[model samples]
Target: MTKTKKPEFRPNDFVVYPAHGVGKILSIEEQVIAGMSLELFVISFEKDKMTLRVPTNRATEIGMRSLSSPDVVMKALETLKGKARVKRAMWSRRAQEYEQKINSGDLMAIAEVVRDLHRADDQREQSYSERQLYEAALERLTREVAAVSGVDEAGAQKKVDEVLVGRAA
Candidate 1:
């Protein structure tokens, strides 16, 4: 007996791939790989010329998904303005976990990291690794936000900072 594959990805669909948040499906094509033919979705990111091919049936299982709705995006933004949780642990350990969450490509997770690592007007300076992690989280979140909001990445970053500052003020 053989298992059948179900197709969940469609052309022109917007999907958030872990690590590269938001991209649009360019096409679905059959490709031969080592004497086996398989169907894959070709996704393209406008900001970058890179194209990603994902297995049609495993898109969801692998955490590839469409962008959250407006309400979802708003909720994620609101989450960014909340309290920051800094664990009292070694920097190496914390850095590893933060890296994993950023690579997860989930908007909420990215937002959590951004919120937690965000520096305010009165806060002390962050360490080199901390700054690196914060920048990575912010970059990942802004890219997704920009794609969803139809704004540029820098503009989206400013929008996020504005929201955080508004809450802080």
Candidate 2:
């Protein structure tokens, strides 16, 4: 059988972990466990102040990946400009689905959640849980956008807001 080559990611490279947002690779380490040598990627999330150790072999399986490309980011922003589709389902059910989408590490899916939950200044306010979910998804999307665009979080947020507001107008 032929062997498949493992994906190579280097130290100081920015990566996205599905459950988390953008993080930088601090180092790659190897350790012996149960008589087996395992390699790991040591990633640090500055916003959350958390470090994650992911097995090198399982990175793809776990959806760990490099930052989204400019084209992908443009598509995600386009997704934000689309009309919101709030299902008639119960809030709890919808919330769970939104959470799943945000955690899926797909830029478009996260954009959908942000679009659906976004409220204009004059619109009715979001419920506490709804607000929480909106912020979480927004944060995730913005963090990646910021990294990919070489902008600060606030600047990325403004770019996202411009799209959302333009769509609403």
Candidate 3:
């Protein structure tokens, strides 16, 4: 077994947990689990109003990461302006893929989902599940964009909208 390395994080630092979008580290604390003391990172998701405690050693393994860089965010926004690539598979299958992408904590993957599932004004509407998946992906993308760009959620959303509408600035 590989030795669990200590994670490099501190309180109040923003991090991306794979299953949760963006969260701030509340504090690092120790707790006894099955007679063994364990070190954990307490993370709070303000948007979800939830708190999660994860083993500090497990953070890297579980895909917890620092915020994306500006260059990466710009690349994801560029992805938003591309053509949608809906696969020929069934909706259920496609939906599963989209769900995975949204929770993957990879900005580009989430951006692809937003681009693929976006419905333009002239286009037909999406199914309920499609709408849900699209919104989830958009929300994840928006949060990361907001955190990286230092913009509010509304501003981040507007920026995404402008790109989707072919008026990216």
Candidate 4:
């Protein structure tokens, strides 16, 4: 409904999607959809070849948000090296929860999932689902970290893992 409050958005602002990492706000446009005029923020993610249009008014409620602060991102990276929490629950159920957390677009939550699922360099193999979730969370978290830290995704991810290693030792 049009009753949703629209937050002020800016071009070049960094945002995070639940499953995707940091993306930039590319443009704001008004489009007529089904006879209703709506304002949308066009976000671009080159890595994923994806462009998302989020309604300006419902951004916050839908979990569309700006990048986290460096300190916040740092805290998330530190979480990565902590011990994993392997629940005895079934994989499908856990996977659904993980997917929800990822889609929430909350950077810290995503980081927590990433941290809890990460396998150390010498750890045994992860199941197909585990590996998929791990990569999804890792990519989502690192992309936001990279945007906030002004580094590339690979470098940001490397730094996060390095920080984890330091904490482990």
Best by TM-score: 3
Model 3 TM-score, 2 decimals: 0.95
- Model 2 residue 163 lDDT score: 92
Clashing pairs in 3: none
| lDDT tens digits by residue: candidate 1, 64-139 | 9777777777988999878888899988998998999998987888888989888887889998998999988888
Pairs with steric clashes in candidate 2? none
Off by over 4 Å in 3: 1-3, 167-169
lDDT of 3 by residue, 39-59 (tens): 899999998999999999889
Better of 3 and 4 by lDDT: 3
For candidate 4, give the lDDT: 0.80
- Residue-level lDDT tens digits of model 2 in 83-158: 8899999999999999999999888899999999999888898999999999999999999999999999999999
Off by over 4 Å in 1: 1-5
Ranking by TM-score: 3, 2, 4, 1
Q: Which is better, 3 or 4, measured by TM-score?
A: 3
Clashing residue pairs for model 4: 6-57, 18-102
Q: TM-score for each prediction?
A: 0.87, 0.94, 0.95, 0.90
Name the weakest run of 10 consecutive residues (lDDT summed) in model 2. Answer: 1-10
Q: How many steric overlaps does candidate 4 have?
A: 2
- Candidate 4 lDDT over residue span 35-70, tens digit each: 989889899998989999988887777767778888
How many collisions between residues are there in candidate 1?
A: 0
